[model samples]
Target: MTAAFAATPAFAKDVIVQMKNQGAASAMVFEPSFVQAMPGDTVKFVPTDKSHSAQTIPSMLPAGVAPVIGKMNQEMSIKVDKPGLYGVACKPHTSMGMVALIQVGKGPSANLATARAVKLPPLAAKRMNPMLAKAR
Candidate 1:
């Protein structure tokens, strides 16, 4: 079974999303890209000594919520305010297929259909398959 935030009372919890490279190819990626969160949860995107900026995809954000963008390792903390799926990408490394998915709220799911229908680039499409499959 997947993790559910409903069982826990709403509170401020922080989840760190690391922007780094892995293996020989030095494939840039968002460590633990697929994350489960609740409203009021804070997702922080952290980069190494290098550069990386986090931003929400317009089409992938929930309805009525404004998209968020964070500067490099200098400043990055997204406070979720609604229950839905959020798509995050590294503005500089998106072409390298760097992407992340965040689910906010209880179990079952919310705004997933809309989130899945979003169109992504080739590399992103490939890396996102497994992440999306596990969302619930």
Candidate 2:
């Protein structure tokens, strides 16, 4: 008698994004604002500064994905199992342009346009524009 076995799946990894009060080019920012991740990878938002937190931009979440909100001074990790672009912001610093863009999987994202169209405060928009451009 013989038996057959299934191969194990690839392991998911974690991507660390730091929330800082001061970054190389700006104040109140997420280091490496643009991230490329694989499905099932975890995006961990580490608050290097206690004043910062990470949360999802409602209009920028992929279909079937729930919003992620973190408490100030705490860290948050979001497991991205779907393929698309995810927009994250710091509730208190969003207006000051503290945001991050996580692109999961390869190829184009179906929600790119929708994510770009979401209205943001002037500073947030200014900071996100470049990140969004690279998402395509």
lDDT of each: 0.80, 0.91
Worst 10 residues of 2 by lDDT: 1-10
lDDT by residue for model 1 (1-53), tens: 23576645457699998888662334888887789998888999888647778
TM-score of 1: 0.83
The lDDT, on a scale of 0 to 1, for candidate 2 is 0.91
Predicted candidate 2 versus true structure: per-residue lDDT over 42-127, tens digit per residue: 99999888799999998997898999999999999999988999999999999999999999989589899999899999999999
Model 1 whole-model lDDT (C-alpha atoms): 0.80
The clash number for model 2 is: 0
Pairs that clash in candidate 2: none
